[model samples]
Target chain A: MLASLGRGRLLACAALTVLVSGCATPAFDQARALHHAGDSAAGLSVLISAQDTIPERDQLLLLLEQGTLELFDGQSSAAARQFVSAADYIDAEDRISLRDEARALVTSEATTRYTGEYAEQLLAHSHAMLGFLLSGQAESAAVEARRAGKRLREHEDTLDSATFTRALMALSFEMAGQTNDAYVSARALPAGTWPATAARLAQQLGSSDADTLAPSALNNALASARGELVLAVATGQVSTKYSSHLNNGLAWQIAFPAYRPVDAPTPALSLQLANGKTPAHERASTNINQLLRQSLDARAGALLARQSLRLSAKHNLAKELRAKDELGAQLLAIALFVSEVADTRGWYSLPARFDLYRVAVPVGADSLTATVRGKSYTVDLNALDYSRGPVLRLMKF
Target chain B: MFRSLSRSLALAAAFASLALAGCAATTRAIDPGSDIQYDAQYSFSDKNAIVKDLTDSLLNRAAYSADQAPIMVVYDVVNETSEHISTSGITDDIRIALLQSGRYRFISREQRANLKAELQEQGAAAQRVASARKLGAQFILAGSLRSIEKEQPKQWRLNRKKLVYYSLNLEMTDIQTGEIRWADKAEIARESSQPIIGW
Candidate 1:
């Protein structure tokens, strides 16, 4: 009996070692422990060490975890590389467990069916982030965005929600001080594309997700897109709306009058006190024009100083498109509000100038016969125009 | 002994949770409240002729396809915002607006496609890419906005101050010889939450 027991003990020892090393090893536990213990680097190291023992494919989960942590600390480019690499390794159809969990949290009913790509969804998150960043850099960023947009439109059917989001983000970024992200989303937003992200959200808020958006949501989206159309059409700024100087050196030397509210449709919310073109003050060596021209450089410096293009843990807006639960409602509200203005406002006008105009009309029986900058033309209903020299009949209504 | 081990594991898990909690406590969280504090403005699809007029002018700005000479373009822009947004947003927006304008035609993929044939012929294509006499883009225009923070009491809320102010600048540039072709500037300001003084 003692001999048999001894043999059993030896087998048990071997089995235990195999079991620990096979699936959940000591190092794996250590990594999880570190991840929980506020030492992500240590966790990463432990995870990386375990890679030699397991399949490289298994490391995808570990890479994703590490990449997420890296992104939160503002390492977007690095995080992107990690994510792209993981994508290259895995099939697009493989369900991401983490993403699945997030999706589950949003749904109220039992989820019996789910299909699609999580990586693509993550790409949307990335695109939205980049779009948000680009919105802040409306000038230089427009070129690449325009190129990307044209590419996305040609393959729209094949593009997923995330890719669509990227294209839209590009559209949104260009729509500074205006209406929805779609107004100027493309250096070449397509001729007939109508984005429904905001409308979808509004619809989800008011109706069941199983059905299409409520008419109200569609109306809201349509209205927002119209706001974009106003900027595209009225401003005559195909490539540029505001002067560099206007953007910088904004030290308005308005004889500082308390702003008189223009009683218009979208009544001017501006105080009108400091809307002066002249600077309140400037260095003697720098004229206001020169000061303003050089302001983007200063603004760039300030931007660099103030914010880093890192990921956020709590506000994972990039991942929100996949997270079905009206996740970006607040953000969507903010973004939609911004998109409307960016699409309608002239770049040469102040951002607040966008507040003055209430609505625009075709000035004719057809939708295409509107006047801008003094010229008239017929166009499709969905056309977005941001060029110059067309006449716009100023409607004070 | 097993019970004792379970108790120890519970303590370890609690201790682990504490470390994560501590790290998060030190980091500053982005303010989620300020996300929706802005106003909404709108436009209409019911209006079409207006959209056409707006786009046509934009196309006129980008019409660099005269067949007789190359177009020249230079990148110029302004930073008029407190937030680090890209001017490309507006510029690209302008480009799209122009594409739909119908009156103007920019150099298309076909024109660039001829570059290889040009290179096969000699450095002539390279030179054309550099000259306004041979390329597609005539000029590049760009700009930005500047805003300042103003702390004023909220009109609707008690004792709460609102922050506001925004401004803009724009410029056009000649691609060849890098000259400032034309420039313009404008400003707009907004105030949210005026003082409900008596409160």
Candidate 2:
């Protein structure tokens, strides 16, 4: 009996050590650091290699990061394929798995499959739209727009209106000649936050809002230009979630997920056109960090309730073991404490914010240079065919 | 004590064998025509139903000369749905059905580029081959696929319900006159319910 108890204690200590060490480092930390260092190709390679080693439950997170890196690397078609696979997986795993939930109650929330936050789900479609647009598949981009609109409507009651997605949807619909749908999406844009191009489009489609009817030089240039160029710039890294532990004086403690704020400055962008023309206007479109914080705030009540229940469950198990063997109870308590970790997984490759710029190009203009954070990136207009629709370019800093 | 230890080892081995057997993968074949609703998203059965309905409609309603088969070209079938569907698959099946029925003649859309390249190569080589003549298509067949999906509102419920409606619209137009000679649409609406709790 003594030898058996020793063996059991050794196994328990080993399991506890594994659980504690696993929570020491958050997922995607290395890849995110590499991406922030301006080597997105290396970051993408890390994720692609990890696909063989990571658990199947984490595949959605891997795909989201891989898709973002691929998009930044100018592999638009490959990025689109990744987003499509992610969307399909999200659809297939729509239901909550009871088995995983039960296991999570005893273990940690990390044991459950990462189904993705609502913001991530919506952004998947948004990124897919950009992917298709960048690849010159305007019709496929329109399809993604429709899908994002559906998801937005489903969560409108809880989620703040995604202004950036709505702008892209309107542009996609206009490019596809779905005038009525474009007007609808344009109308959905919040007042005072609508981009200049979206407001002009709404007004052109006969919007009754007085704000949209105001005439401006930018709108006039946009209306008269032979083609328009849309530039989207992403800057800074989003704040990461960390495990926060709360302990009482007794043998009771709980772990919850919390965000460590990141300081990301607004990027300044200036365009120098070959024809000496300037961009019509620029605006900050989406703040992903803010969205993430709001989503976590909304779930605070449920998370607290679950943590309370887990504490009670662990305490009861320990008490029952104590009635049988005091040493066993103590060992179980130590193991439970180590295993109670918070789920801090997320789509970490997303930028802190997105900014949009609209430039009107004359028929013969061939190139332009955009300077962000003192680094100039040139876009060659001669290589792109603008007769189809507006040309989109993405720059990351 | 030795006897008890041996019995314990035997029990452990049996349990391990049972767990391994449970993890083994198995495969079987099933009829393709059977309706299998795995989820609310589209499936192979939906494709078959749409193809069958649309092809039947086209074959029965097409207006053409009784003695001469209409020479046609299958153009782009645009996908306007939320899901990524290969619209070409639908058009390919329709072309096959029309040809097998002996009611329509199709100019190969996929082989056009290869044929053009082959003709260029022959011309460059100056080979003594018969002159290749390209046939002109009289009618163009084109279509679009669209879908609408709705989910049950978030509330206290044991199951979530989703409804998806898909429509495929096809038309045959006279290339010279720019007139639509035949048009038809096939629609499929399905509602699926998933349990909120399962083990």
Candidate 3:
């Protein structure tokens, strides 16, 4: 009887191990690999094919990744659709689910629905804005810009101001012929964030600036240009979270997810006209890596406190079972340890930094050359239907 | 002792499995007019209410002769709100209600393209007949939807509250005279609270 009981306990332990391991498998490894290999189309295909395999809990992350790949694949309309779906899901899931939270505390955070980090949520709106602008839906783009601003305001206490989204909002308002609204957005931009562009836009929108009173040639060109060409280039990959183990001389070790250190310099992209006249270079408008770090930092205290509570609960349970049955206690301890794996899943396909370049294009100007990371690529402005408003072109590396 | 331990282990395992499995999803039909609100965001109740109120206001308030229904074209309702609301839905509902009341007439904006295509296909023959058959709208119906949302500031609280107010202002303009003849607005305001901590 003793031997059979021991065998039964071992079998139960094995079964628990299998269940935990199945849930711990990362969902986006294959998709991320294909995306980083410069095959976003293939990456998008993999995600679509694996839709059934992806748990409902990870649907938000999947949508975000698919949207990014779609945008990179030059399917802006399709990308916009995906982002809209994501936004809908986010809106519907705005309230926390008690059931999911309960399950997360007992099992793993991965078991809960991925509501999305604050940065990811804001970027969803920003990307949707870009997708609509590129597809010549200026009205839809303006709506997304307002949505992004609303989200920023909702989380103003926790998140830093997103300069990229603010700039896009100003530009979208301008395209939609809401000049007063556009001026409001432009003036709201933080000082020294987009110095030249903001000043020029504010000045053009009738914001009298003593500093910009002198009429420079660039100002004249911008004032008389037929349309503006906006280039957004994404460079380098954002850092990923990994499982971190902590052994504090306790019976059970604590495991949590931590972001890997990313120390790369901000990347820049410069645009030059067909006549070899280089426009003023602007600093990177957004640093997603920093945003991710700040988001994680903001939640660190909560995460650690939850982990501590979980440790105590598991330890107490194991200690009680040890007094009743030695073999069962051992089996339970093993099961708990295996199930303690961190939830490191996240939107891994995002770029580390975003560089935006805006320049006024004269009539009949078809294309311009963009130089980034010692490589030059010709961007076609004529392909876009600029009659609606300013045209946008995106590049990823 | 071993039996009790086995029972205890089984109970714990069952609890863990239940937590992991979660509750299965279920769906049931409810009355469309039911005022059920899940959050501060817009809901179907709001849509239903707006359509009913606006349709009633337009039908009762507009100055028109009972001899004949005024010819009108329902233009686009610009969505200036943050949400991706299909303002067309509101316009479509209002149009349906007005037509059913037999108090108004509407020219289909979507069918205009088909009408143009048919005229082009028929060349000169259709144009000769179209000039006499073409109906000109006397009033143009247009509007815009806007919203103002306010969120509770982050603080040490057990619940977070959000308030959203939506205003849909619609108007009828005299096409020839370029004068606003009628206007009305429907508004919805809702507040929702969500618990910060969940079991």
- Could you tell me the TM-score of candidate 3? 0.81
lDDT ranking from best to worst?
2, 3, 1
lDDT of 1 by residue, A18-137 (tens): 332223235545654554444557766665667677433245554555554344334545554554454434423332344433322222101211221232223323332332332333
TM-score of each: 0.25, 0.85, 0.81
In candidate 2, position A91 carries an lDDT of: 68
Candidate 2 lDDT over B148-184, as tens digits, reads 8888898999998989999999998776666888999
Q: Native contacts retained per candidate?
A: 0.03, 0.63, 0.46
Provide the TM-score of the second chain in candidate 1.
0.42
**Residue pairs of candidate 2 with colliding backbone atoms:** none
Task: Give Cα distance to truth, residue A369, candidate 2, Å.
Answer: 2.9
List the global CA lDDT of all models.
0.35, 0.75, 0.75
Estimate the overall C-alpha local distance difference test score of candidate 2.
0.75
lDDT tens per residue, model 3, A287-382: 887887677777788789877877777677667777767877777767776677677777889888876666777666677887767877797767
lDDT of 3 at A396: 79
Model 1, which residues run further than 4 Å from truth? A1-75, A78-397, B1-80, B84-87, B102-136, B153-159, B194-199
lDDT of 1 by residue, B1-199 (tens): 9999999999999999998888774656554323333421111210122223433443445345434333323222344333334444444444455555443344554554564345333433235435433665655445555555544321345443445454445555555655765555443444454333320
Clashes of each: 100, 0, 0
